[model samples]
Target: MVLQLHVWGPAFALPSIDAQCLSAIAYCSIALPKDAWELIASSDPSVSPTGELPALQNGSTWVSRFRNIVDYLRQYSDGAWDLDRQLDESDRADNTAFASFVESRGQSLIDLSLYVTSHNYYNNTSPAYGNLLQWPNQWILPPKLHGAAKARTDHLGLSSLDLQAIEEHRQRDHSAAVAAGKIPKNLIQRPRETVSGLLGRGSSKNQFRMEALTADFFEPLEAMLGQKAYLLTLKEEDVPSSLDCIALGSLSLALVPELAFPWLRDAMRAKAPLLSAYTERLRRRCFGDSPVEVAHAYSPQSAPASPLPWRAPGRISIAAVGSTLLAELADSTPFLSEIRRNNRLKQAAADSDLTSVEKGAVSMFADSSKKDMYVSIAAAVGGVAALVGYMFHVGLISVASQEQEFEEEEEEGIPDFGNLSAGDILGL
Candidate 1:
């Protein structure tokens, strides 16, 4: 049976929007043959057993996340699919170290460039998600992702890059200035601070910070890749390793895509031209020239006798939508938020050793399933009540008017009992 790799849909000319999914796709592109596996742009995480993307399906079993998928594939083929198998002990150790570094630093940089910065997010990354997802999901997922990115980069202490926050601060200052009967300078300067002017607003400080962030991440990788075509390998013709795939995953998002800010990409090209070149070569080698078409080419009808490996955008089941809507609604309620927090604490206590991403998957399904059920039931009941109330309000469901009821009573009069005695009937 052909293994199926379900990942986030393609965007910005890349195989996947997410770094993890891109890494998984790159790994599969290198390790597996064309006929052995097929790519699916399933985008939705609810289809995954683990509530994560880059889920690998082999017949009835599914493996989630890029690292887990790699492990499973290695074990599946008894090391035949292991890209790191050829490395020495020392090289493997280096691989592990660099992978962690890339995940943390690289991910932070991506978050800053793509999500934390309001300009780039609103203009570029947000639209990218809109292109990838369906109606309700398009509305929901982008902000959720932006929130996640904000949470990840909160410790970076580079709030100056967050233009939205800066604007809010400016608004507060203006309000205070007006209240104190003082005219703020920005009030007069507002017309001059257009998109072009934003770059020059605090150019020195913001540019320095961005450059520092870029250098902190790229300098090490550039040093590692020096004079070699791939990281951890000396030969130009050697196959790219798992480390290469992982690095490419993050670097492609940073370097390949044309963002509104483009600081990271600019810095990468300027400072680390060698690594940039290496990333381009590897991306082409793994995904070929037309990566978008390669990623999204397979359709259900491509293999008539077998099951479809892909789910089209907006093609989710009604049940899935109902559950998602209920979850979103539940998340908005204070009581449910508290309940969710309590569940998270309890789950953390129970599974203290698991990594955050893996813990998220487990807790999402195991701890929150009952909560989701309860929320769904409550939402259904509330919806029914609302519908009935609306009908009553609109006169679709009405009781007789008091005057009409009185008139009907008078017309009917007191009911005469046929079985009553003759004297009683006559008196009545």
Candidate 2:
């Protein structure tokens, strides 16, 4: 019997890179049974409880959330989808951090696209459908007002909508990106494009936000490429045994296309074939005739002349209690030892001195100085260590808290798994 897989979503309308990556995985020969996959585009809430695109159902199991979907596919695929197959804990952590950054910020790109589409960019001269409006708002606005706004909104089209959406998405995106250690905080306010007079000059602020957001990923990209020749590679034999394929597949879809953006493309040209091939394939698949224009349209400012290499840089901030401890240990070990040695010399000087006044003064000075030094060092070290411990405790608590969140999210995302049955897809 043929394996049956159902992907329910308005995937075309959503146009999310992450969602597209999920589609790619679903369509990959190694991951899905031949010609057995189907995509359902209905908006019925019952079809996907989360009201999100890209929920997957196969046989007796239902999976939602991109990470869980990747995990579930890896189990049966023999780990073909594993991204961290060869990575150690630190490397894996780095990759996870990078992925989280991409996932969180990538939404901005999607939102920009949606905003444009809703504004009626394509057939605006004489719209087939009324002017598309904002998404969450469009879902509720009355039909009459939407029609009246059509001309003005359509004139603004994709570019204007995208510009605004990028600006709006940037605030939340930057906060999340910073929290993930993706970008420096300074870039958060940089300016780029100007809004037309009617839109007001303040619109230029939005452009700056996009530039700032894109800057964060540059270092991570350089780091990944600098470490290995292939952007990410998995042995053909291990395709089914790891989730590396899924992660690579996702990253390839997400970052590769952005290369066409002049700033990003120029930066990636050092590894031309890898970036070119990845972008070309996606352009052909998604944008077809207008690949070059689409690529350039999304381009940021020209790439930097010498981008920073990806090894961790800058002073370690004690953002979390755990990091504080690590920072303290890293910063104080040598200095603390030096202080101890210096104290020993001072004590010897006190013992050998002939003048009682001098000896007493030295003793008093040494006593006060040593006490101060010890207290200062101890406080610094102890504070950091305690912070580090507290950070870890908090992280664990957060993870536990998320367990229920994930379940609740899942419950709202996919239909009940209990309703599914074995042999509904592949018998195995």
Candidate 3:
């Protein structure tokens, strides 16, 4: 209850617009509007010691970045509700790499859909933020957001860029992923980056290209899950990992029509349907049904003790009850398609040899090289620092000074916002 997290909210709207805030809440497992921690929404970033949305103020500790906030939780909090608490050393590395993937590629896609696209920006994101404010801000802030996003969109060359250009960008990302080296050798045997794989299932139309690029984000995620109850292997008592927290965080905004573009959601569903269902189970378990809005919440029920007092020889036991329950729920709901999808993804991943941890890399790319330059560089710096600290934590790196150097490097330079509005830039 000592943690007071500041997120974005509305005076007049439905679900929240700020995905970063949603990510923070998921990482912290605050149990939404029901939890003890205070969640406030203010347009002002001055209150943040580091001037970021979703800043944390807990006792004497202060944090403004997602990666740092995660580390703080690992250091200070109990493991009971900690999402990343259950991760093994290898899985911790996997979680870190995949979390980087989500923040870099996944976040770019969300930003484009929400604020840069003409229809979505004017129709959805702007009005949504406008609704969050009082009388003048209600009327005032949205246009500034639109102009800024439009300028950035133009600057990124989203419209003028072509397929060939996108593939080139993919090559660059592929190179970066190879250099990332964050994923360990036991969890992901990184897939071969063939031309077909790079372009994403072969298509010509821009929408096809867009769909393929978006689908790329889900490929590694689906493969990683295989057939587990959650993304990582966990016993009944184990909590989710940072991998799970981040996946939930990214999907929290993308899955909802109120918050994300319908096309983007459809693309994610089509690409990673199994992961979608897995996300549903995680969503229901962690956030509860209607966590963001209103619905009939279904909490998975625990099985009672066996009727017989004594243990019987060769007695039939329950067949994977926890996951089975979730599977049954999927079968009964409209998400039956996802149940069917599990087999397809499983087959594809098996054929590609992707479900293991031997290799590494994800080559998801859009049409412009400049498109991800800003966020990619930003994530790489923080991701490297985190990996170094993690290595020191697990004794993978022996030198204390090396960890200290990286921790100091983690205090990165302030980003240049270019033409973005203060509201748009600070809103994140």
Best by TM-score: 1
Q: RMSD for each model, in Å, please? A: 8.7, 28.7, 26.9
Q: TM-score for every candidate vs. truth?
A: 0.75, 0.38, 0.52
Q: What is the lDDT of residue 227 in candidate 1?
A: 93
Q: Residue 356 in model 2: shift from native, Å?
A: 66
Per model, state how many residue pairs clash.
Answer: 0, 27, 8
| Lowest summed lDDT window (length 10), candidate 3 | 294-303
Each model's lDDT comes to 0.79, 0.42, 0.55
- Candidate 1 clashing pairs, residues 3+ apart or interchain: none
Cα displacement (angstroms), candidate 3, residue 147, comes to 5.9
What is the Å distance of residue 49 in model 2 from its true position?
5.1
Question: Tens digits of per-residue lDDT for model 2 on 1-428?
Answer: 23222232112212223343343343333445434443332222223433233555676555555565556666856865444466667666765665666554443333332223233223221131122222322333223223433333443233454344556776788899989989987774757443343235545664454445444544455455443433344332322212233334333433443221223234334433454454344333332332221112122132121110111112223343343345345435766655655565565454342488777777677678767787888999999999889988779768878998999998898766686687664565
Clash total of candidate 3: 8
Q: What shift in Å separates residue 229 of candidate 2 from its native position after superposition?
A: 6.1
Pick by lDDT: 2 or 3, better one: 3
